[model samples]
Target: MMIHGFHSSRQDFSFGPWKLTVAKMHVMKSANVEKLADELHMPSLLEMMFGDNVLRIQHVSGFGIEFNATYALKCVNNYPGVLKVACAGEWEESRTMGEHYKEIIRPYDWTYTTDYKGTLLGKALKLKVVPMTDHIDTEKLKAREQIKFFEEVLLFEDELHDHGVLSLTVKIRVMPSSFFLLLRFFLRIDGVLIRMNDTRLYHEADKTYMLIWAIQGLR
Candidate 1:
């Protein structure tokens, strides 16, 4: 089975210098699809879509990041070369899209695997992307501290026409000592393979710099 989208009844969250917003509107209607197509100029979007799922995490005077469907799909097309993936006749949407759309998708990965790390925001912030020589304190995050606020937001998702699942999601948990946020892109192609891309962010209430680490895996 497949799901178009889901709704989250919670409001935005804020802890210390961080500000978070989770927007989960219904699936894209025809008008939404048309607008996105016109704006994105990508015919591959003719398959399936969820235009309203967005998650944004910003800082008062620091670095920030955002997750949304529009940019993620854009990455799938711009991902260098064709991926060794296919849904064949299992993908109902691709089958129904006919030949013209298939031609447009032939050069791209129809499985919708995205290498999108996240859309970074804030120019004046003192955020630097150094090598992951250092790390997020796993022991601290694993501690049983008092969680002030927590929320999970689904940025976008697809069932790959019933072949498997591809989705991007972001979640954050705030504790008295510090806060942790995880943004992930996960793909499962059933018997083929499973790949995961993770971006983890951690911040201590007493520090000015936030620790960020990114990891990728395929099997």
Candidate 2:
């Protein structure tokens, strides 16, 4: 069976709320925090960025409905209260899979003194990032078996056909108080599992935020 999940609405993809949260976190203020960025809330963010109909299948063995990056970016631009798209680059041709995944983990600077610094542009982009190691150590599975497993699990299931996935589960860290992070998951089809983790900060060009990702096809 082909199982799929829904992303957030079209209005929830902006980094404004996420940026504001970071500002508050840095200032150590306890005021009421409203969610703005998709990082903190993946489902809501997905919904907002991709809409309820982002993924759908026509029939078994048929090409499923898909969403594209152009559409995804357009949705991101539609959110309310966006000061501007702080992220730099065209996103389509500018970023590659490796750079894009790196951006998702902490896409913000966890440390205060980085190139991007404390601004949303800095905080939303990734600086130095790495992919997590696959923990399955074994002589039982042949190298090709392992390779095939990972390829089926990670690369195939992800929404890569549309927009390349920027930042995956291995890098993202969700809040425990609300338990929003626990519900999130990376894609795994046959045997591959990508657990994206969130780091802090992103990379930018010419004083503008750029979408960064860290990608690995592993066994």
Candidate 3:
């Protein structure tokens, strides 16, 4: 299922045991307004730390099941060359069933890591800003495509299940150059996978861009 407009105010969908509803979508743009004001007078520490050119998309969603996906972006030291993208989330069922379901998924063990640097798909997963490339083609790079990229490229699954044997999985992707980040939340119950949310963020030369898709289904 594909949604056509960014102006859509509300949408609802469901699959299997999962149901999703989305509302109140809007875009926001911001610059270093505080920094500009500080420069005219005396600057404080907080004002000096402000960076310019930020764009964000805000939306609300309701999932029949409890679910969340979040990402944090941080600069490596004081240098802008490298950035770190960290992701984490949780899921819980409406009711508890048995001991078997409780132990289905465990907390993320950060001691292990995988390197996808060698394969063809791995190489393509790294997104870098090309000086003159037309990177904002919404037609070629749809919201769904950006979401699917992580599921195909990076492998990160930390899940938990409940009494009904319903499972929740989280996947994350961080580009090598720190230009892009993607997070996906998935719910699996009765041997079927339902995508709950897809969120993507891009840091470009002049601005930060965000795109999101929240989905749910009903019986």
Candidate 4:
């Protein structure tokens, strides 16, 4: 069974040696806001996005393969430590601070860039980055197969205090013969900049190894 829109929505499926779960939930409440705030050192970016949302999908295999595709506010919001494009001044509209304004954001990347790929659950083997010799079989994706399950959820989003939009989302689908997923972090600073980070995973029922591809860009 599956549920949606609530704080604890989840779905699970089992096929062969694989067990996968998708958990959808709402943002953190006031009880957890303090914890999220503690993870964030910069007040400006916190004021803009707050980073409270949480959504995740977990994959477990009886052959010792355990993985989590999670979209959490704090995980994606904590990268770059500082902006590389000098765009921190986007949050400075109609506000005046004598000395503490720039001091807070001088070392933070308000763009909310992150290199987070995914989480490896305990007892999971570490990932090895080998030379990519194989690619996702898009031909299988184009074929008309009966989708057994499909889910897409937004992990988090922020308006950048009116400068632009920043959001991260993830989706997954289970077909009769395989499974496929896509995770994306998209940002647009109006006329200033645009950036994207993507991760894709595909697995076939007859295959022993799942293929994962990650691509990121800034422009």
Task: Specify the highest-TM-score model's number.
Answer: 1
Steric overlap count per candidate? 0, 50, 7, 0
Residues 75-185, model 3: lDDT tens digits: 011222121112111223322236764554332211111111111112223223233433433443343432312322211222332311211223333232222333343
lDDT of 4 by residue, 1-219 (tens): 112545656677775567766666555454454455445553433333323323333445323232222323445444444444434454643232556654553344566676566664434443344666889999999999999988876665667767778877778788999988887888888777788988888889898677888898745
Using TM-score as the yardstick, the better of models 1 and 3 is 1
**Candidate 2: where is the Cα deviation over 4 Å?**
1-10, 13-206
Q: Choose 1 or 2, whichever is better by lDDT.
A: 1
Model 2, residue 29: distance off in Å is 46
| lDDT value, residue 216 of candidate 3 | 30
For candidate 2, the 10 contiguous residues with the lowest summed lDDT are 147-156
Q: Please, what is the whole-model Cα lDDT of each candidate in the order they appear?
A: 0.71, 0.23, 0.26, 0.61
| Comparing 2 and 3 on TM-score, the stronger one | 3
Ranking by TM-score: 1, 4, 3, 2
Model 3: residues with Cα > 4 Å off, grouped in runs: 1-178, 191-193, 208-219
Error of 4 at 191 (Å): 1.5
Could you tell me every candidate's TM-score relative to the true structure? Answer: 0.80, 0.18, 0.24, 0.74
State the lDDT of candidate 2 residue by residue for 1-219, as single tens digits.
122452222211112223111100011111211133342332112211211122111212232122222222222222222211223223222333466545642332111110111111123333333444432122322223211101000101223323333322211122211101111123222222333322232211122222233232321
Ten-residue stretch with the least lDDT total in model 4? 62-71
lDDT score for residue 217 of model 2: 30
lDDT of model 4, residue 17: 62
Question: Of models 2 and 3, which has the larger lDDT?
Answer: 3
Clashing pairs in 3: 13-216, 13-217, 14-216, 14-217, 14-218, 15-217, 20-216
